[model samples]
Target: MLVLGLQGSPRRKSNTFILLDRFLQEARTKGCQTFMLEVCRKQILPCKELVICEKNGECPLLDDMHDQIYTLLRRADVVVMATPIFFYNVPAQLKALIDRTQTLWARKYRLALTDPKRSFRKGFVLAQGATRGKNLFEGLQLTTKYFFDAIGATPAGNLYYWKIEKPGDMAAHPTFSEDVRKAAADLLDPLVRRRRVLFVDRDGAGLAPMAWAFCQIHAGDRIDADFAGIAPAGTLRPFLETAMTAKGIDMGFFRPQSINELAPSFSPQQVVALGADVMETVASRFEKDPVEMTCWELPTFDTQDSEQISRLCKAIEEKVQESFGMA
Candidate 1:
C-alpha cells in the first residue's frame, strides 16, 4: 500500500510538517510505502478557470502538476493532506492542488470514465490551527470532502488540533505522537487485514486484466488485488476494453507491466496464474514464502469476436470470485 502525504506548510520544520512527518512515519511502521510532497516547494499553478477540464478533462497550465502530481493522486492508496489552518482553511499552495483535481472530476462525471483503483482508495486530513475555535476545521473539512469525492476516494479519518502555532509545539505536546500513531492504525488496519491476491497471465492484454478489473469491482474491499504479465503487450486489447466498458468499468490508466517489474515490491499471499507458462516464472521469482498458487485453464478464443470476448470475461470474473471466496 502507498500512503501519499501532501505537506502544505511553507516552512521547512513547521508544526504542520512535524505532525505530517510523524503521521507518515507511523504509517511506514504499519507496512506501507510513504511518499511526501512538499506542496509549497513545488510549482503548482492555480486553476486558470479556462474550463478546459470540463471540456476535455485536460488542464492547460503546464507545471509539476501536469508533469507528475496528477498521476500520484490517482495511484495513491491513501492520500493525507496536512496543513496548518490559514484563515480557517488550507494554505494557498495545497488549495491549488485541490482545485486542479477538477480534471479528475470532469473525467468521472462529464466524460463518464473511472479510475480503476478509485473504489478502494481513501483520503484523510491532518490539520492544526493557532486558536481553539469551535469551527476551526469546518471549512477545511468540507473542502476535503469535495476533494475526496472528486478523486473518487472515501473520506476515511481526520485529526485536527488547535492552539499549536509555533515550531516544535506539536512535538512538545504530550498526546500528539500517541494520537498520530492511533490514527494511523485505525485508518490502515482494515486495509492491511485484507488478503493480497496477484493475478498473472501470459501477455497482460486479455484475461489477467479482466480478472483484476472485476476483482477490483466486486471484492476490492475484501481482497487487495494486483495483476501483471510474464510478457506484457504494449497496451490492452480493444475487445477487452470494450467488454469492460459494457460492464460499466472504464479501464482508465491501465498499464501493462512484466512480473519482474512488480515482484520486487508486491508480496502476494495468494497467486492465481491464468496461463501455465507464467506459473514457473512466478514461482521462481516469488521463492521467499510459500505463496498459495493455482492455475486455471481458460478457453482460448479469437480476440476480435465480441461474443467470445464477453464470454471470456464472464469466465474470468467467475474464476476470480471462486478463487477469492467471493462466490
Candidate 2:
C-alpha cells in the first residue's frame, strides 16, 4: 500500500511535523510505501475563486500543486494531512493545496468523471493546536472532510493534539506517539491483508459487472473484485442485472464506474479486462504494476441477443472459476 503524508506546518520541526512523521513511520513499519511532502516548503497557489476548474476540470493557476502534489495525491492509497492550527483552522499553505483539489471535485461532480481506484482509498487528519479551546479543531476538521472528499478518499481517522505549542512539545506528550501509531495501524490494517482485482470494459454497463458478480459469489472471501468502465455510461445494464439474477446473483450495487482518472489509489493488483480495448485503457492509466496487467482472449458477445448474453455469462463464470484455482 502507498501512504502519502502531507505536512502543513510552516514552522521547522514543529509539533505538527513530528505528529505526521510518527504516523508515517508507523505506517512504514507495517510494510507500506510511504512518501512525505512538506506543503509549506512547496509553492501552492491559493484558489482565486475564478471557477475555471469547475468548468475546465483543470486549475488555471500554475504551481507545485499541478506539477507535484496532485500526482502524490493520486498515487496514494492512504493520505494523511497534518497541520498546525492557524486561527482555528489549517495553515495557509495546506489550505492552498486543499483548494486546488477543486479540479478533482469538478471532474467528478461536474464532468461526471469517476476515479476507478476511489473505492478503497482512505484519508486521515493529524492536527495540533496551541490552545485547548472548545472549538480549536472544529473548523479544520470540517475543511479536512471536504478536502478528502474532493480527492475521492473517505476520512477514516484523525489525531488532534491540544495545548502543544513548542517545537518538541508533541514528543513530550505521553499519549501523542501512541495515538499516531494506533491511527496509522487502524488506517492501514485492511489494505495489507487482501489482494484486489478490478474488471474493466468499454462501459461498466456490460461484461465487467458480470465478471465481478460471478467472482463475488464464488470467491468473495479470497480477493477484492470490482468493475469499472473506460467511459462510464452512468447507468446499470438492466439486462445484465436480470441475467445475473437468473443465475441467483443479485447485482443491485453494480453501478457504472469510470476507469481511474489518475493511477488508482488501489494499486494495479490484477485487472481483468473484457477485451483488448479495456486492457489498453488500463495500461495507459497504470504503468507501475506491469506484472498484474494481462489480457485474456475471448470471443465478444452481443448484448442485444439473449442467447449470446447467457453464453457470455457462462464463459465469464468459467474464467472466474479458473482465476480462483490460479489464486
Candidate 3:
C-alpha cells in the first residue's frame, strides 16, 4: 500500500516533523511504501471559494494542488496528516491543501462516481499543542474527518499530544512512541490495495467473459471485477453468447476489449491470467510486475458443449474469490 504523509509544519526541524518521521519509519517497517510532501515548502494557494467544482468536479485554479495531489490521493491506500496545532487548528498551508479537495468531494457527490480503491483506503492524523486544554484538538479533528471523507478514506486513528512546545517535546512523553507505533500498524496493516482484480484469457471469447460476468453478479459489491484479452477477438462466438443467455447473464453488448485500450492510469491490483505467457505481457506494462497475478491453465472446451460452458464459468468464479481474497 502507498502511505502518503502531508507534513504541515512551517518551522524546520519542529516537533511535528520528529513525530511524523518516527511514524513513517514504523510504516516502512510494516511493508508500506511511504511518501512525504512538506506542505509549507509547497506553493499551494488559498481556495478561491469558487463552486466550479460543484458543477464540473474540477478546480479552475492554476495552482500546484490542481492536479498533483489528486494523483497522489488516487494512488494512496492510506493518508497521514501531521501538523502542530497553530491556534487550536492546523496551519494555513495545510488548510489550503485540504480546501482544494472540494474537487474530489464534488466527484463523489455530484458526479456520483466512485474510485474502485476508495472502499479500502484509510486516513490518520497526528497533532501536537503547547497548551493542555480539553478542546485543544477539537477543531483539528473535525477538519481531518471531513478531509478524509472527501478523499474516500475512513478516519482510522490519531495521535494527539498536549503541552508539547519544543522541537523534541514528544520524546519526553512516556507513551508517545508506543501510541504512534500502534497507529502505524493499524493504518498500514494490509500494505497493498488488493480489491480490484482483472481477469485475462486467450480472447474474451468464453472463459474470461463468463468469469467476469458471474463475479459481477455474485460478489460485485465486495470486489471490482473486470476482464480483457491478451488477444481480443472483437466479439464473442454465437455459441458462447447463447450459452450466457441460457444462464440469464447478458452477453449481448459484450465486445472484446484490449488491456492497452484502457485508461493510462488503469492497472488492476490483482490479475488472473488463464493462459500461458500472459504475465510476461501484462508485467511489461507495470512495475508491480504481476505480484497478485497468477496463471490458471485449464482444459479448453469446445464451443459446442453447452454444459461445459456452465462448468468453466463456475470454476473460474470459485477461483476468483479464493485467489483474490474477495468477500
Best by TM-score: 1
Clashing pairs in 2: 116-260
Give RMSD to native, each candidate: 2.7, 9.0, 9.3
Query: Tens digit of lDDT per residue, candidate 1, span 1-327?
Result: 668899999988989898899988988777776789999999999998999889877888999988778867865789998999999899999999999999889888987876777888999999998998799999998899999999889999888998998888888988989999999999988987778888889887778888888887788788877788988998777888788877767664466668787776677888888877778887887778779988888888898888987888888888878877789
Ranking by lDDT: 1, 2, 3
- Local distance difference test, each candidate: 0.85, 0.77, 0.74
Error of 2 at 72 (Å): 1.5
Encode model 3's per-residue lDDT on 1-327: one tens digit a residue.
467889999989888888888898897776566788888998788888889988866788876775367767765667899999998899999999999888888877876655444656778899999999899999998899999998888888888898999877877778888888887876565543335667777676666766666665565445555677877896776776666655545453346667776423345676777777676776665554554766787667776777876776667767766764563
* Clash totals, every prediction: 0, 1, 2
Clash count (model 1, backbone only): 0
- Candidate 3 residues lying further than 4 Å off, grouped into runs, are 190-278, 281-327
> What TM-score does candidate 2 get on C-alpha atoms?
0.65
- In model 1, which residue pairs have backbone atoms overlapping below 3 Å? none
lDDT of 2 by residue, 55-109 (tens): 7677878888866777678656789898999999988888888888888887778
**What is the alpha-carbon RMSD of candidate 1 to the true structure?**
2.7
User: Residue 261: error of model 1 in Å?
Assistant: 4.5
Candidate topping lDDT: 1
- Looking at model 1, residue 32 earns an lDDT score of 74
- Alpha-carbon TM-score of each model against the true structure: 0.87, 0.65, 0.66
